[model samples]
Target: MSELIELFKDPYERRARLVPALLVALPLLVPLVCVYGPRNPILTAVLGLLGGCGALYALASVARGRGKKLEEALVKEWGGMPTTIALRHRDSTALDSVSKRRYHEAFSSKLGIGMPTAEEEAADPARADDVYIGATKRLRELTRGGRNLLLKENIAYGFHRNMLAMKPLGVVACVLGLAYGLIIAKALQLAPLTFAPGKIAAPGLAAALTLLISLAFFVAWVFYFDKDSVRRVGFVYAERLFECLPSLQPTMPRKRTTKSTASSDGPD
Candidate 1:
């Protein structure tokens, strides 16, 4: 438990932003050059290079944003006492007794009050144990119920991570664009199709353009929708943790007893 607390105290490690950006841009540029040439293959290739750069820029932005958000959310949740306890025991009830006891001792000790005797401590690890189990139990239950909801958020975050990692949509767009350019160049070679007299490669060019546009839309969806899922999850978890804070603090009421006096009635 101490180790877990220590671990949560450390700053989070984030990946370099450059890596994902480079991956997205490199493949995307290949298709760009093939589609937009200056009638000179060399010049066309140069233009195509821009595609890679754009993809890289977009992917890098997504990765950096998601990574930062995830780190911040985790820190917020684990940095506090109540949230930390909830997360630490999100899985099992084994630590309930120990955690309750430790919290109780810490509270009493901090207030400069005498610690309960071993026998009294052993009698009930909860109420007398210094820590209130009712509140902890309530927190534990809230955390458990929220687990599935948080999991969905985690999964959404993961998908965004993969999108940043693989840059799949960007690669697909580049490939489709390249295919269309090649098809147009092939059709132009067979015979001059008089669509626009000079626009003989229109069909193939259109396909490639459509593919690039589709990829752009997909990327937007990933950024706006998928990324938001992770943020929402973090928000909910933080809120729940805050709700459990009162219970984490020990609230011991003073024990009160009444003294009785017997009255004598004139020898009855």
Candidate 2:
């Protein structure tokens, strides 16, 4: 049961759970409260309890989708790689360790790149350009020929590239979400759709409407923006795979400068 709960912990899953309940309740609640409001408190509470079930259903569906997306991404990245890949197994251990030092140590050792010191390990994930640049440079120095392949294929390097792009995008996403939420809140205050007549009391109704509208816009924004962002991040990841590893350096095509030919008559 605990494991099952942990499975749906992702943000996508949580939002999925919340959105559906709001959608269902948003329509039903206004009617429900109007019909059997302050007069029948017990019945209203019971119905509210039952309505919460929709949230659970939403959570399961969203989590399944997230899991599927992750699996598809992994399948695409893994391609035809063999089952005995050391990095595959090493990743599990690196994730389980609590300490940043331990995680980086395990990851670097697995990739045959020397581990960074404690201070270096403590660098912020959002801005690890200096750390990765230095570590990647050292990784190149230590490699002879094919050893660089290890760094090229390291899952951490891939995630780092993906998340590096995601960091700023995430901030922008949050700002957009907050703005959407605020707009909804303001709209609710201006509109009078409350249970009571002149008093305008229905907190529940206001919350539901705001959530429904704000979430819809947020989902639309993510669909439009994040799809392209994912592609660009993947490109950066592939670029990093080539740049970080010296073994693949020679394979990269060098740009040639075009030379201009002057007229012999003009020179004379």
Question: Please, what is the TM-score per model?
Answer: 0.27, 0.26
Which lDDT tens digits does candidate 2 get at residues 41-112? 997878756545453554445433443344345435643111111112232321233433443443354444
Model 2 TM-score relative to the real fold: 0.26
Off by over 4 Å in 1: 1-31, 38-62, 73-87, 90-159, 162-203, 206-209, 212-268
lDDT of 2: 0.37
Pairs in steric clash, model 2: none
- In candidate 2, clashing pairs total 0
After TM-score superposition, the amount by which residue 200's alpha carbon in candidate 1 deviates from its true location, in angstroms, is 16
Q: Write the per-residue lDDT of candidate 1 for residues 120-155, one digit (tens) a residue.
A: 545743333223223333334334434454434333
Residue-level lDDT for 160 in candidate 1: 42
Candidate 2 ranges with C-alpha deviation above 4 Å: 1-43, 51-268
